[model samples]
Target: MQQSIMSTLPLLLLLLFSSLFPAPSHAWGIHGHLIVCQIAQGRLSDAAAAAVRGLLPSYAGGNLSSLCSWADGVKLRYPWSAPLHYIDTPDHLCSYTYDRDCKDEDSFRGRCVAGAINNYTSQLLTYDATSPSTQYNLTQALLFLAHFVGDIHQPLHVGFTSDKGGNTIDVHWYTRKTVLHHVWDDNIIKTAENDYYGEGVAEFVDALMQNITGEWSQRVPGWEECSKNQTTCPDTYASESIAAACDWAYKDVTEDSLLEDAYFGSRLPVVNLRLAQGGVRLAATLNRIFS
Candidate 1:
């Protein structure tokens, strides 16, 4: 009886911990991460694709999208990484600077989403097929880089500190009581999938792919380019996010504001554009890293 009681203690502690600190809401949700990674995998160069396939475990079947949300799932095990998913800027400032705003709640510098991108990009850069051992886990690094790239593009991920990037703001998403951050992360994308794509994520991806090759074709080159030929340009992406947050996301939004068709219709385009950019940029970064 003593042994059996001891054996169950770990499980009981886990349950208590979960109840005390529930999993924080993930940025972009699972489908959003899937959409970004799927688009990215489709755009990888031959060399990048080969490297990605070699790094991925057998269960993944060489599909990076299959594990795009792996980082979010491991948050409990990697408690320190929670801060790496978003940057909280000064309320109403509507601007982001790495030095000033990139710290976590503990004020540790270079600990935000943009910094995570740079850190993981550097880790993946050390990948070498010739080396039998590496100091870093390139597989985890690749996964982190891919996910952070997607996170930085979500406007509210770079949102105001006072509101915890809209996570604290109580709002009704078309009669459903939810936070504003979730409205962007999952609700909007889910609604788009349901209403326009017949609830098919693949169909939604198809439409974005078409737009990328069609209406947004010319902008693709610019999106994929990092200034000064850097491997990744997350700072630029974060800057764009805060601007979008101010101009679109936080605009006309307040505590308990009901958001419906008018809000959805106008903001869906921004969400789509950001997702497209995240995919394009992830591919570009991987191509540079593997090249």
Candidate 2:
């Protein structure tokens, strides 16, 4: 009996650790979030920049990018926030509607990523409220807004519900095994950094910044436009993501499919475009909020 109990100790410890730190389902990895926030901080209006600086904690050193992944980090502490990272659209629909699909598994409306974006945008809008009773934590609102904006741009974040945004669809990214969702979340970005950017995220960000001003300059104004002059337009971002999920992410792929150079080369442009749009729109939303 003593020998058996001792043998089970390692198994019990493994279970405890696994329960404490479950695998993450974040939309974009840390590098992706950092890239988006860095781009956004550089484009902030003078007033917006000052407001951001004031809202950020001193430990952040006024660099919004440094804490862009704060929302993902706090998921274990804030379990209720897990559902706000993505919208699980109906299988094969290739479309998104706030009224139709923006809810959690429990059918709570306005509980999806788009809804989170709207909620945070509204909270941050009260930055200058004359009333002193504003209870909203504007700092948290900013971090969540920044993170969800990056989340909403990831195509798989608005993917088919059957696969839980591709989390269930196993695939091979080259020789390594991973899921479709993780492919979008981290693998593609990691490959880009290693192969093209010398394994440096800052270099990847600089390249995207140049494209924002050079290759993608003409179309950026359209990306920043919000219907009816809304402060932020997450629905548009979500819709684009679903479309891209169908056209690029879920297209011609299946369980155990091997994704290699063909997949990477075709999808990298879409990834780049989405990351750029997330950054630009985040900046635009902040500029509107603080103006």
Which is the leading candidate under TM-score?
Answer: 1
Q: Give the residue spans of candidate 2 off by over 4 A.
A: 1-23, 129-133
Tens-place lDDT per residue, model 2, 1-291, is 574355445434434554567547567998889999999998999999888877766556778898787778667667889999999999998999999999999999999999999999999988963332247867778889999999999999999998999999999999999999999999999999999999999999999999999999999899889999899999999999999999999999999999999999999999999999999999999999999
> CA lDDT, every prediction?
0.89, 0.89
Q: Would you estimate the TM-scores of all the predictions?
A: 0.92, 0.91
Error of 2 at 83 (Å): 0.6
Q: List the residue pairs that clash in candidate 2.
A: none
For candidate 1, write residues 113-136 as lDDT tens digits.
999999999988888866633487
- Residue 43, model 1: lDDT of 95
TM-score of 1: 0.92
